[model samples]
Target: MNHTDHLLIFEPEMAGHQPLYIRLLYHYLLENKPTLKVTFVVHPDINKRLVKEDGIKLQTVGNKINLVFLNETEISASLHNTLWIRAVNRWRLMKKYLKTTGANHGHFLYFDHIQFPLALRLPFLPEKKISGLLFQPPMLDFYGDEKNLKEVIRNYRKKWFYTLMLNNTALSFVYTLNPLFPSYARKHFTNGNKAYHLPDPSMFPTGDINLSDEDCALTKHVGENRKLFLLFGALTKRKGIFEVMEALKHLEPEYISQIAVVFAGKLEAGIRSTFLDKVDFYKQNNPNANLHVEDRFLSTNEIISLLQYCDIVLAPYHRYFVGSSGVLLWAVGAKKPVLTSNYGLLGYQVQKYHLGISIDTTKPKLIADAFRRYLNNPDDYERNTSGMERLHAESLPENFARIFFSKFL
Candidate 1:
């Protein structure tokens, strides 16, 4: 239980990109950091799902990779379950784990949930060498000359939080997925030098990915000549599903005929009926629209298969979306182009890397116009080879691991 040459990775949630992030880090440690003893602390449900059902082969990797299942709710006790309560409870779990294992360093895979509590209570906590990966830093969302009262208050509050969190002597480093935020942080905050840019990993399954019958069937609908525009991952209204459908209405039949739109991944239960109804209505109106829906959870391999099959990746996120996206990285990894929102960090990256077109996704006409331009000459919008190479180099899973362990190693 007492190991000085050890690092503990604490993660609770398993949905969305959590599992992929953990797998990438875990496998990286096992392969590259052979001498480092690492312990992964996750929820009991994740233990049952990832270890037992998914067969990640952590057990086969010998004792170097320690799997510890700690139920997060146990730490919460009988406290009224607010966000602060939950954040504090998670922090308590991490502190206890660090104390129990005598780990030299601690890292949080997803720390945005617990950051405020940790910042406020770090003085009380005994841990000295702890770091966390921040996916969404509100400071990055602040555009110049804020006029809204509520927005100004929120921005100032975030600034205060960042000031406390970064200036704390206990924190070794705060890793960020926003590659551009580190410079801004260093210039603005007192101890912002600790802000390190951890590349958002874009790597996906390549070579011969085992495709299912359903996967094969999904690709068959794209036919021979038409370009496929794919909107992958969890389907929610915020993903601009309605905007896409409305945009399709603006395009001419000939334009719609040349392109196919596929809504892949599980539709949010709240909007499933509405989404299906829209799809049906679109089909009824434009018979040659060529729209397909794989309304369920897609495996990593299946997603990669789809990525390889598709022509353009649609990432028309809502205006409020400020964080980096896994979809953008997947598009880059696949050497494909994306039509994303020109609002926040996503817009900055697409424009910086020349990944594809960035526009105001709120307007259906803009989305339609982007499609028309791409359809006119797909080669004109294709991501450059150098751009893809640079993005890939920066976003490799190995870089994510290296930067994460920079303080410890």
Candidate 2:
């Protein structure tokens, strides 16, 4: 690893769970390959989740990585909603960054975000070697107001459409974070050795999580005789949080007092108010409902601590959610099992990894039945911890970085 190879991870626009994985991978590459000169081009605006130091410590080493923040690569109030404009601005910034770094003919570039309409198709940039991690393929998306008939047609067209889309890109390799991506989606990439399935390692909980499980207020609800089941992360209808809460109400009274359910994460104002009303109803009828809510986004330390506190993570996701669940993986990282959806990528990953129980989350009775099952024998799900360490080893940020650069470059 010399001047002959340079790895550039272009991540100027942070969105979704990118911040969580970016932080994990950044620290991994930093610790594992200290001498490797990697350039990290980040967004000018600082996000604490992406770059925060616990206490007053500075996370950046300032030597291995050349942090180039573009001042003009941003969208303001008037035209901020337009994706095309912002993407183009970031695109312009990327070209400028390559020039500024004096990147040579065969340097490696990884774009954390997938570009659109005018996508980040690097075939045009032949001088530099390229690799990208696709967080969402077109097949993972469903259009607005699409009817059931049209949706069926779209699902059929999407695999072919995605295959063609990636086939045309001149990238040396394109990796999908989801290993369960429809096999037919890429006839060549899967079979021709062009596309790789990089199991997403985005769920690494922040530092020393197991050390402070007793320090968090959330865990206090999990008494010696009680088991804790958590519905963590942002609250939304798509995540099946409402249905989960409703299911909690239907839990048998004996089970209700024995199991504590927590919904923790930032809730939109309307959702928060409605959630409180529902909780109030439960409280008025019987405190045995035992539901607690921590309605705010969690910090890195808090997230890890919360996961450690949780006995079982609930990811009863909507079947329509095509991608994987960060919450489910976070639980896996904490060596906990999940109660999740039985359809789509989330379920596939859960089953593939043997991480938890898959349930038809759309039905409240099914959810309640699943909860009863988990309570009957939590150890059944806990047995899946054997593969997690190996999964993390392969998915370590530096390992992913090494696999692409060492093999391709």
The candidate maximizing TM-score is 1
Report the C-alpha lDDT of model 1 over 1-409, residue by residue, as the tens digit.
Answer: 1233788888776555766677777877877855778888875565344453235644425767888876546633413247777777767777788888777777788777656865695443554477888887767344322235765676677778878887766677788888777888988888889888888887564456676775466787786789999998888888899999999999998899898899988798779999899999989988887999988766566677778899999999986666789989888888889998886788887877899888889899999999999998887674777887788778887777776655565
For residues 316-365, write the lDDT of model 2, one tens digit per residue. Answer: 87766766567766776777788888776766667777888887788888
lDDT score at residue 12, model 2, on the 0-100 scale: 48
User: In model 1, how many backbone clashes occur?
Assistant: 0
State the weakest 10-residue window (summed lDDT) of model 2: 105-114
Clash totals for all models, in order? 0, 0
lDDT score for residue 344 of model 2: 67
**Best by the lDDT measure:** 1
Cα deviation at 134, candidate 2, in Å, is 1.5
